[model samples]
Target: MFCTLLWGSAAPFIKWGYDLFSISQTGDILVFAGVRFLLAGLLVILAGSLLQGKLLTAGKAVMTPVLTLAFFQTFGQYFLYYLGVSQASGVDSAVITGTGAFISLLMAVYVFRYEKMTANKALGCLTGFAGILVMNASALTQAGGSLMGEGLILTSQVFSAISAAFIKKFTRTHDAVLLSGWQFACGGLALMLSGLAMGGSMPGASAAGWAVVLYLAFVSAAAYTLWGLLLKEYPLSRVGIFNCIIPVAGVFWSAALLHETGQAFAPSTLAAMALVAIGVWLVNRPETPDKRSENQTCGS
Candidate 1:
């Protein structure tokens, strides 16, 4: 829940950062994101090492997973997301990206075979998605979602889901925080290079702009490190369902911080929150003994 809230603040903060830094071009956005993640990676490594009482070095054993995550999680996901958001409506982007948890569930159950596809998981995902729809009901009625825009956003979600599954798998053998930090470092570098290659440059930087970058970096560092630990110990569904809370938190922070409070406390927003909370509960609810027994039998 805390991690999701941190992530939710990101959209509004990124917008603010762009304005403060005078960022308008796609290349500049990529460079900004790259810098944030690079700083975040360093913070995680430094803090995680201090906490663990040793240096968090990436050995050859961990390099494969680190690079894999760097590609899917950091560089690929954010690259597509920035591009997609530029072309898509904010409502469309939110609604589409909200499917990330649902995608993670499906991939975990089928592709990874890490868990069974239970009725509870399926229903919970659907319910959460419906809440997202209701929450964005006003803007959704405006009919502006294009193929390129929505398509790229959905693709970015796929990368995110894949990264989650791989994190769960990798953490079984490697240190979760170590993997996260190094992967972030690698991916951030990649994004920086890509942005620079595309003629991106940050011409102006203020103390406030730098502060925003630092805060955003901390958000990613802390949230992802803790989230990696959670995935290490729990089923993907158990942790992933909380993703629905992100958009809700984003709306709240956007309202309070960005002063887009028109519908912050509206009935629709409150109702949507209720639906999302219920969906999270349903997903994390313990399975009945009978259901577990049936699953075991089916496995045989």
Candidate 2:
């Protein structure tokens, strides 16, 4: 719940963060994303050390997953996502980003073999996707950003889903807190290096800009750590379904913060949220006892 809230708030704040820091180029967005994650990774480690009475630690053997996570999850995901976020409106970012959960679910089924693909999930994805399209239909023609902008944001979710699968697979023996800390740290450093190499510089932001950065750092620290823990205790679909609420909260926060009054509470936005919720429900809906019995009977 809190995890979803943290994520939901990100769309608005990210747009505002760009404005606050005057991010204008891809290099700048990368640098900014790098800074935010680097700070977040450090904070997560610090919090873990304090709460657990020791420095956050990881095993040498788990280094493979850590590196993979850093490359794919934090670094690859954020770099592209920032490009998308910068191009699209905040509301669009929020709505489109919600589709990541379904992407994760799909990956879980095919890549991880942790779940199976069913008709229900297929339909759910279509419904959710339709909602995403409705939210962005007008923008496709209005010339805010390329179709690539929305595409990149949606693609970022695939990496996010992969990250979750990594956590679920690895955290069987290791601590989620440890993995979260290391991946963020490694990924952040890598992203920062990439940004610097690409000729990106930190913008001269005001005090307010620093505040936004810090808050984003905190959000990642708390949410990623908690999300890691939650993944350990629940199946991916169960936990992932909760992520659907993010867009709703994101839209609200964007409206309130950015003062997008006319579009915030618009009919289309509400309808999109509703469709997504229903789609998520269909995705996460457990098989009924009768259905189980019927399957068993057929097998027999």
Best by TM-score: 2
Clashing pairs for model 2 are none
Query: Can you tell me which runs of candidate 2 are displaced by over 4 Å?
Result: 141-145, 290-300
Query: Can you list the residue pairs that collide in candidate 1?
Result: none
- TM-score per prediction, in order, is 0.88, 0.93
Estimate the lDDT of model 1.
0.82
Q: Compose the digit string of candidate 2's lDDT tens values, residues 1-300.
A: 898888988878988988898888777788888889999999988988998999877678878878988888899899888888887777878888899888877777788877666677788888898899888777677765467778889989988998889888888888888888889988988888888888886686889988998999898999988999998887786687777888988888888998876777888888889899989988766667876455345323
Q: Judging by lDDT against the true structure, name the best candidate.
A: 2
RMSD of 1: 2.8
Give each model's whole-structure lDDT: 0.82, 0.84
Q: Write the per-residue lDDT of candidate 1 for residues 1-300, one digit (tens) a residue.
A: 899888878767777777788887877888988999999999999998999999999998899999999999999998888777666544345545667888898898889887787888788878877876676666556676346756787799899999999999999899999998999999988898888888997757999999999999999999999999999998787688778777677777767666766666677777777777777777777889998777556433
Score residue 83 of candidate 1 by CA lDDT: 72
